[model samples]
Target: MSEAATRTVTTPPGLLASLDPLLREWLPRQRWFAGKGRPVTGFSLVAATELLPSTATLGLYHLLVRAHQPLLPGHVGAEQPGDCYQLLIGVREALPPRLAPALIGHVTQGPLAGRTVYEALHDTRPAELLLEALRTQARIGGLRFERDPNREIRSGLVPRLVTAEQSNSSIVYGDTFILKLLRRVVPGINPDLELPLALARAGCPRVPPPTAWLVADPEVPAGAPQPVEPYVLGVLQPFVQGATDGWELALRELAKGEDFVAEARDLGRATAEVHTVLARALPTVTLGHSQLRLMVDGMTERLEAAVHAVPALRPHASGLRSAFTALDDLAAEGHTWTAQRVHGDLHLGQCLRSPAGEWSLIDFEGEPARPLAERRMPQPAVRDVAGMLRSFDYAARSADPPQPEWAERCRAAYCSGYAEAAGRDPRTDPVLLRAYETDKAVYEVLYEARHRPEWLSVPLTAVRRLAASGLT
Candidate 1:
């Protein structure tokens, strides 16, 4: 078993002497290691940022490793990386007087806050680098990380911010640049590393263009083995300033009973457009039925476990079972929807309405629970559209608990939108769209009931409708 499969421990002193040299052993011990749970066979340094002294461990490392993916490739595996992704990591700059609490072990600039190099940012005068980040907008997907909060009268210099998502707390200069420390890493194409480039290349009007990437070169530093693993990562792109957050925006529209008629319609069109582009860029590879069967079987087992986890979710097991059935049922109907690469998770909250009245998409990372492999599968574009419809319904249900009328409107607007783009021709007879919608609703019910109880109404309402209408 690899240390990745083991619990991460604080790095001891002697091992910290040479940060790079020890990383091969220590890196695997850390939680941020991206390469699934596979044992680290061997690793090579791909990139390193040591402009500072080796003792100064508070820099970043980009490491690459060769590991096993078990019966498959690294891209398709059960082990997934934790959320905190960054190219920068904190290192011990000097021998500790005794055992510095804050400066102990190489940690996230996060863990070493007021004690190490990261602490200097909050000092009376920040590092000169702060001046640069403060003055200009650090672009990463229309999100500019800035220094001046429009409140701070100090050195307008923006301190190179750590991502707000960090546990120790990195300030959000202006939500532009998020200095997320690499707390967990899963080997393969970093979504943050890969998404911006792909979307930009595909001309998917929503995401920002890739500006510059921060990577680690193992050879850049002396004897680093895991060079390609880019420990601390940050990507800067143009910021979409003053834009409303999609989640909040969705909530407001639902409350106002604002029929997202046109918006939903537009959403359908946008989804279709993006799918065409994604198919072109990623291109779909035919998924073997054996693989599909295994995926469906695995999902069934997982959903069964989920039902067991939360008793309220047990009733949903039947509906959940339906997803598996639907997969087979549809194919049985002689309307097999080929699996292809897809935007795993899509919903209203992942989209925004710019001041210019156009739809903008964000969060290309797919479903939070589904393994990356399943999420990357190209199933049906209708799945995406159905998710949005469920989202719209969810908003309405949450906003007006007493009104099913609103839910009805959501369903109409969404399908109206989807139909406009995907042709709504019911690829399968007897209008399989209802079954598609039901399939999505059942998923919504199971997922939201567990994660967001308050949002359960969206799927519940859809379920009621589905049960009443019959699963096509």
Candidate 2:
């Protein structure tokens, strides 16, 4: 790692204290903030490095802070910790007209009193500074900006902040590269960077490889044993120009009432190819009786929790419980299943279609709400298959009149395509497939009931159908 000659400056004392009031009001309103509907009690600074010194006219500070919040309804006794977030805060004596919208608030006390703070990514200079650091592999204090030695990044690509409604923030660099900044971060090797690198090394072209990435060294005690791994902050990858997200493409086709079977089939093939490579690139495990029992137990636990959270799911609870226990019944017969690393949150939105009709999968971050270890765990590929299948159902149901026939055709086509590429159709394992699908629907039910009451009908419709099928 190359170190820049610029002297590193420490964060001003009491900076966080002064910003707490402003953040408590601003953080929850952000689309990327995870602690929605919960009050931010306080914050503890994990690591703070002055990217650009406070003495400068335009100062930039990189912060990793843990936001403390109240425990969930049932997790009071559990060891639940707050979420750590990555922030780029810019400080200026006065705001420019262009940066007015990015303002976080004006500090009234402490080191930065009377100065304005705003999101740094919205400013051109700060965004350029990040790219230059990555291009040069510069190590600034605890932050390490590294790039692929083989890939040459040209200097000075214009930066544009992506305004998409997502769990994270992004910045596109002159249509050549895109940087995805993870807001709610954890201390581990994030799968977003880990899996794509593995696929790239295995010669899989279905996913884009990261060209640059940011890592934060652990802030261990002076005499304590050093941590084994650093926290992954962000990833930079080649931007697929002229690409349309699968969700948008599907909606467009559905609005026209056009057949999407061909695209759905090809998407299945793409998914299978990625899965095949992942199995070869990573270690695979066979889940036997004990493992299957544990998995079924987790499913049952989640179902009970969902039922408690959303009373509407109570009627389907019996049927869903049966779907989960059916796995246990098979385990009793000496049945086993293969588990490998997979895209934990596979859905239409995670896929992209190029202008030439080529498909590419992005965002290996998995379910952001899940623990990093759990998200990285090896799972039955049918889990991903079930996610896509549910995505098709979602698209169909989201239509004006609800296109059940279209969804069925797409689902069958997708399975056929998977069988062709994988040599084993997921439909062949009816018991496992139904179990995973049931688990996904239960999750959706809770999510919709809590976040979008109007959209509750979408997943409820699936719960009704799956329950009627008896999940046998």
Best by TM-score: 2
RMSD of 1: 10.2
TM-score of 1: 0.62
- Candidate 1 local lDDT, 199-291, one digit each (tens): 777777866554443332222345645543423234445445566655577677777766656766676676666666666777575545555
lDDT for every model?
0.48, 0.91
Which runs of model 1 end up more than 4 angstroms from their true locations? 1-183, 216-232, 286-292, 368-370, 400-403, 422-472
Residue runs of model 2 more than 4 Å from their true location after superposition: 3-7, 77-80, 222-228
Which pairs, if any, clash in model 2? none
**Model 2 TM-score, 2 decimals:** 0.97
Displacement of the residue 294 alpha carbon in candidate 1, Å: 3.7
- Local distance difference test, candidate 1: 0.48
Clashes of 1: 66
